[model samples]
Target: MSSEVDKGSSTQRKEGESKRSKPILTRSVSQLAVAEAQHLVLWKKPLSTIYHLVQYMADNFVYLYSEIVRNKIFVFCGIIILIGSYFLDNIEGPHQALFDAVKKNGYWMSYWTFLGFLSSFGFGTGLHTFLLYLGPHIAHVTLAAWTCKSLDFPEPPYPDTIICPTQESAESVVSFWTIFNKVSVEAICWGAGTAIGELPPYFMARTARRSGENLEEEEQSSAKKKVQELVTRFGFFGILLCASIPNPLFDLAGITCGYFLIPFSTFFSATLVGKAGIKMAMQTSFIIIVFTESYLKMVIRLIAGIPKFGAILEPYITDYFEQQRIKLKLGQDSNDGGLVSFLLTCLVTGMIMYFVISTINSLAQQHLIQELKKQSKSESKKDK
Candidate 1:
């Protein structure tokens, strides 16, 4: 009886030891997995990483789609506009005629007619219309003034305007105020669009603050803290100062204002003045001065005098200017509506896609953080 009891006791002890060993091995493997995941080097396997990221986004498509459609109305509208713009560009025949008719007759008559496309270009946080659309328009106007010796105002979708300057107006003076007045409406419209683009960040930050989810000081960078401090100190003037400059950090300003629960009217009014009023005026004045005949000629001379590559570039530059002159004289559209237009459309689409992806990722991260916080609070309460 003693021997049987010893055997059974030994067997039970062995079984317990085996069970404990199994758990230890499992835990070690899991720890190894987590360590490897933490140390994943994306650059070493960029293609694979991209593939996985794309797959993950695809897998979570439904969740992302629902979030955008249900919660992010602004984002939804932006996406629609982007898609619509792409289609509109591709349309043929009647669409082209309709666009031409509007450009010729209805451009200055309706604010929407002028504002619609310019605003779209200025929409979103990163992409500014000044470089792509407005800057070129200013340059074209300046070029026209130099060549035609008139304040030949290039309208929106400019250098492609249906109504061109007449030979009769060739002797007209292209003064500073004349140029400014011609492009003033476009500048205002574009600036207003940019201000509207800024709203998303503000709204997002405000919503987070209202929900009691504030960004911790430790999570913020030093630059961000400084911006917030500046904004907090000066209020309206602070926002105006930040928005007036061509600063990329204006988005941060928007976010900070929202987080502080600044009133919409105050924030918007300040932004509008800074962007549409001050900034536009500065840009317009600068362009007008820079594109004057003597300055433009000086620039062209400098470009032609570049050491080794000058000879090669000089011909292309000369030909381009000559082409512009001929086109202006004939009152023809500079846009060929072929490869260049397609490339531009592709570029804009890519930017919009990148913005959408970034926003979705940010929202997802916030959601996860909120969930984790809730879980910790619940567990602590349970312990109490």
Candidate 2:
């Protein structure tokens, strides 16, 4: 009887141990699985999947054509053009007269220039804005280049002359200064215009309140006061940073200031300083590149005359010149003279940050609600 009792006790002890160890073993396996899943999801799998997806899209002709035709208005406009061309060909006499009119007195050029100016004003008014959506630096560079090309300025200042002007090089200095000032001032003026854009919406809101419209006065006032306080605290630095940075958010800042009745002169001064400073920096960089070509090429030639490192460096030096040419062209036409790509990148990153923050806040709110519900249920159960 004693032996049988001891055997039963040992069996019970073994069963208890197995029960405790099962959870540990299961938990360890689960943790390992979770970690492996996370590693696969985080980078390796997602990157490979994205790469394959892009490769597939690039290879699909139908998909590519569909994507191109997705712009309905543009496609419709193309169709209209085709139909219009057919009709015009049938009425060549009238079409010819219209064509001649466009050709005469540089009418076509004047028409396009007028349209450009109109578009610039219409589209560029907002807080974080560019002239016709062309970045400020690119717009300035293109304008400067066009002005120089059109006017045929005598020995129009290249970067080299601008950077290293001497007492004897008065012509180059003057030309450089003139172009720089022109571009810089234009940028400043555009900045001011954007600041002005922030005004109308705020005024309209104020007007609605005054007129006893449906707007909630207390909420509007509270929000406005909060913004005003923040702006007042930051003051000049805030304005200057917004103006200097190439982003659409600047317009909103300008509008806030206007809504709060910040002094126009003060606002203009900050904007002018910020915008002009950025433009001047860009102009200086362009001049420096030109200077480098003239001075660096001479140094490179001297080095090439040397025996050992010259051979290796020659190909590199040639490649550098080639890259500079491409850079100069791309800088003028795309991505705001390539000087302000960082600003554009910042704007995009900022937008993504805002999106992520908003999403996190939403998730946090949901979690809090769930926790509150759980707490209430526990409290009810305890009462029962």
Candidate 3:
């Protein structure tokens, strides 16, 4: 009896060791990865469902003009309506004339409002990209763990010292495209389309607020406001068109193009061709125009990076009241030291600018989140 009990205990110990030995590597998805995955989820979801989600997203993200749709309509309607307005501006010219007339008549307030609307339109739809940091890490952990589980699917001793073949092996071409190559791009394309669809009108409204428009009839001409009614319908169509394509790809291409040189010059032409096919199928001409016309945009962007901007101001810096001018590189001199006061001056100025910009951005983000919370509460009350 003693021998049998001892044998069972030893077997149980070996099984426990086997289970504990399984995990050889642990990893976490970066915020960028999460953002990419979410875009994939959005694109994979049904059109109607995505439309509803956009509606929920937009209301929380923007101070969309009360002048626009009063109904609890889908968010994409705004994008559709914007596109229609663009065409209307092209053909009927009613909306364009009204806008021009407003500007001519010293509607500087309206003009500024229009610019603001353009800047923040897609902000609502893209706000969800924050899910990169805001969401539960559980989903990410699960994906990592699921991959680890599949490490043994080919049957393995999965040696402890050996990096498992599953971890080291080249992922299939499809996986490579979808995982590393596509994620960064998906975020950019989706974000840009969201911006294009959502920004113009909301920006207009916000600009009015920013410019201190306190009166109701300040710019409302009864005949002119009829164009806004069409704006809602057309905006929805535009958003639908944007949402259909891999919107993230457009942005990804632009940004990555700015930062990187590899596989881009070769792949970019092909990418544009793919995007052209996509936009035409969706009947969104704006996208085709964007990718086709923006060849110099990235080179321009590379020139305008933050570090490059710092370098631009370096030449103007001159050392004061000295026998010989001191040439100081960045971070080489302490501000209190006298040898390179000019460099110190520039450094201090740059630091101040960075702080002020960062603070304002933080405030903007906080304001946005607060606005979203208020909207959510209002929506819930209305639903009840």
Clashes of each: 0, 5, 34
What's model 3's overall lDDT? 0.36
**Model 2, range 1-384, lDDT digits (tens) per residue?**
999999999999999999988556545543443343333321345554344344434555676688677987888899998898667756758577765554553553343333323222212331223422324343334333432332122232432111121223323332444545534433444444444444444454445445543222122345445545555678777677666665544444555665555676766677656654664355444643443335557766887988997877777756644544454434333343232345456775775465444433333333333344446447657987
Q: Give candidate 2 misplaced runs (Cα > 4 Å).
A: 1-170, 173-179, 205-229, 263-269, 276-384
Indicate whether candidate 2 or candidate 3 has the larger TM-score: 2
* Per-residue lDDT over 35-107 for candidate 3, one digit per residue giving the tens place of the 0 to 100 score: 3333332225445334444554565466455534554475568778889766766676447778666545344
Can you rank all candidates by lDDT, best first?
1, 2, 3
Instruction: Identify the superior model by lDDT, candidate 2 or candidate 3.
Output: 2
Whole-model lDDT, candidate 2?
0.48
Query: How high is the CA lDDT of each candidate model?
Result: 0.67, 0.48, 0.36
Give the residue spans of candidate 3 off by over 4 A. Answer: 1-167, 170-176, 179-235, 239-384
Write down the RMSD of all candidates, one decimal each: 13.2, 19.1, 32.1
C-alpha lDDT (0 to 100) for residue 248 of candidate 1: 64
Top candidate when judged by lDDT against the true structure: 1
List TM-scores for all candidates, in order. Answer: 0.60, 0.30, 0.19
N/CA/C clash count, model 1:
0
Model 1 misplaced stretches (Cα beyond 4 Å): 1-125, 152-164, 170-172, 216-222, 305-311, 333-384
